[model samples]
Target: MIEVSDPNEIAALARDPNLDRRFETPTCPVNWLLLKRSLKVLSFRGHRFPTMMPRDDAQRTSNQQDLWNLLGEKVASIKTGSDELEPLADWVRGIGPDVQLGILVQQLLGQLFSSKFMATEASWDAAKVLVAAPRLNNLPLMMWWFVSGKVRRAKRLLAGMVNEDLSAVNAIGIAVHNVVKSLRQMRVLYANVQTRSGLSAEAAAEQCLFAPASVYRQATAAGQLGDCPYSRHSLFVLSIGEAARHAEGRSLVFMEDSWSRCPANLWIPAMLQGVWNRASVFSQFHDEKLSG
Candidate 1:
């Protein structure tokens, strides 16, 4: 078990069998038209994202174009029962890593929030003004540029997200309610994440996914959580801290574990090679885990 930490190594790990790449649930449902109209009422029109996503007729909560549908088409086209990996690799390889990261980051943010890519708000309070749920969906948009390949574009998008007065009081519990284990440990775990490693956005996103799985797991245990976090019929507490341990790459081994770490969350880093890809970014850390 190689704990990958090297950036180049991490990028290479994207193609690894252990990295799960899929979004198993639906997003929080919001009326795209109504949300847009509400933005005007709240004067968020100026802060709006320019990217336009095509909505699925069935998924009313979604505002971004579904990629697994587009990308999955490629996956489905592969001949089943064939051991050939090149076809799948070819599909992933066809897309630019930066573009792949951009699509993924925008999709992740869109899933957690809605309608567009990254944007800004007046403050944490102002940030949640009209959104439906709240969670730390705004982590590491700055680093998304390198993996996403559109540095200037990523930078411009990140500008709107920076709230000078952002805080836990105003930041949590509104707009983007999907949670991450990192948020609970932010003051300690994530605040000092840099000391442990370079702290890439890809790593941040990858490590945070296991928390959602724990949330879903507990919900299953008590029979209290939603059908799924991404489901419209799903209803439950959308908070973090319940899951502190990594899912230990279980998602890579089973599609069911994909829910634990949303594919949107995993895909960006996987493409960026900071997680389960073969490049083995955390080789140092992974070695200890396997040996210890």
Candidate 2:
């Protein structure tokens, strides 16, 4: 892992798979975006990269423009299965360090959340969001980003529901009742997830964490009650903890002592229900697990 301070050094390391932590301390957001975009181009085709390193600033500027042009073309043609989507998807997933795609995704997600995209009422604006979304669908990196967004959205929706008036509360209660009913059906499917083909829940959960699989497995497998500060079914629980910390605008490590570490409450029942709903649908529709 290279802890590069120079923008040029960062760009140089983008092509190499040896470095695990590509973007180091005090992350330069613009440099990170360019590196991610450049890596995607390299993954799509090795020969697309410049054959020689530019000697002068002018040449470097031209090369940077070339890279940007390539990214524009790729992002523009990134339609779903319209000939460019699969290749782009493959390129993003195939990039080295396995974190480049995640970086690109989080860059886009940050833009989506901070920019006016989420609040856009125009259908064409929403359509543009969908196009970018489908390009990374079903990929592990994309799933992590999506799950992060889903968890955030679920919390926001839950909070709004609880904060509303009586009529709104009644409506929210009805929605919750239906979700509970759906979850009962899904729990049956979770029981068979290990035996079924395609992606397993454990595998999905593994991808959600920022830690090693062994660490996660050890934590979940131990299942020692009150052994740690908090109880967690799996390592992925840490993601929820991190997300909650971010939402509260505090350090994630600090919350570990309270809500994250051995907190006795499974207060995320609605979020869990949403996961079950999606899991069951994917298994039944894509994995053919529910067929007679």
Candidate 3:
């Protein structure tokens, strides 16, 4: 396994056709077995999660592009003052001062799906399980996680909740969870800086938007990324958030200009800006009331 933290190398590696999403080969046989077992948790029935699909998969690519186009429409409407933004902003403002992560996740899920999106405590637990399953290093626990039907039960609970395509359900749940967690981090940062007078909502959102920690890819052929030489089956762990610390690396946060760039790059910041706009107004009103 190779860990890549440099921004340029990470971007170049991501664009390499030979480096795809398949996790078929691991540096060691033990990991190979573990990865295979863990992948079961990310699947619904026999369908792999959309994010786990190989780039060359025609159907997955088409479906992802369709989702991107749909999100683009939403972003466009938002630019023209869609009514949806205020309600979402209000919902975000309503998050408590010290809400638990699970509750925050549940609320965010509702915002992403329908307000009537049925999610239980177990549903959130199951999503957490799926996210962590890929990193499990304990052989016995990994075996139990799959053998005990825990993975199947979790997938069953989430499958078809979003759409008939099980992959869509898994994809939405995982993406929402990840984005919300990053937003939460941004919220903390925003709180520290929001008191500065005349801070625009756009500036606040841009200052606070946190990047994802890392992403993974597997090599299908030998390649040299930067000065690093990697063989086929080499696993590359790209540290995205770390790379984003540098000015040149900011684009790594959303993978800007890359084929795998996040579709919601514009929408996410806009949502954050809306929330900050509402929250700032509320804060000012409260301050005036106190002063009076």
lDDT of 3 by residue, 202-239 (tens): 77677756666777778888988767787888777789
* Residue 96 error, candidate 1, Å: 28
Regions more than 4 Å wrong, model 1: 1-65, 69-118, 123-126, 130-205, 208-241, 244-265, 271-292
lDDT per model vs. reference? 0.29, 0.29, 0.66
User: Candidate 3, which ten residues in sequence have the lowest lDDT sum?
Assistant: 90-99
TM-score of each: 0.27, 0.19, 0.82
Best lDDT goes to which candidate? 3
- The sequence of per-residue lDDT tens digits that candidate 1 reaches over residues 1-292 is 1133222232223322233212122323433322333222222224322111111223312322253343234332222212232222222223233223322322333323233334223222232332322121443642342246433232233334433111111122121333312222221333353433565534544454442321111011112111312223222322233323324333432123322222233332333232222212243466679899
Ordering by TM-score:
3, 1, 2
Which pairs of residues have clashing backbones in candidate 3? none
Q: How accurate is candidate 1 locally (lDDT)?
A: 0.29
lDDT of 2 by residue, 1-292 (tens): 1122222222222222322212122224543443443233222113212211222235434644553453344332221122312222232223233323222222222221133212122322222232233234345765664566632243233224234221222222222232223233333345555533344434432222221011011121223222223122222112322333233322221223221121101111222323433444444675565463
What are the RMSD figures for all models against the true structure? 17.1, 22.1, 3.3
Per-residue lDDT, model 2, residue 179, is: 28
Winner by TM-score between candidate 3 and candidate 2:
3
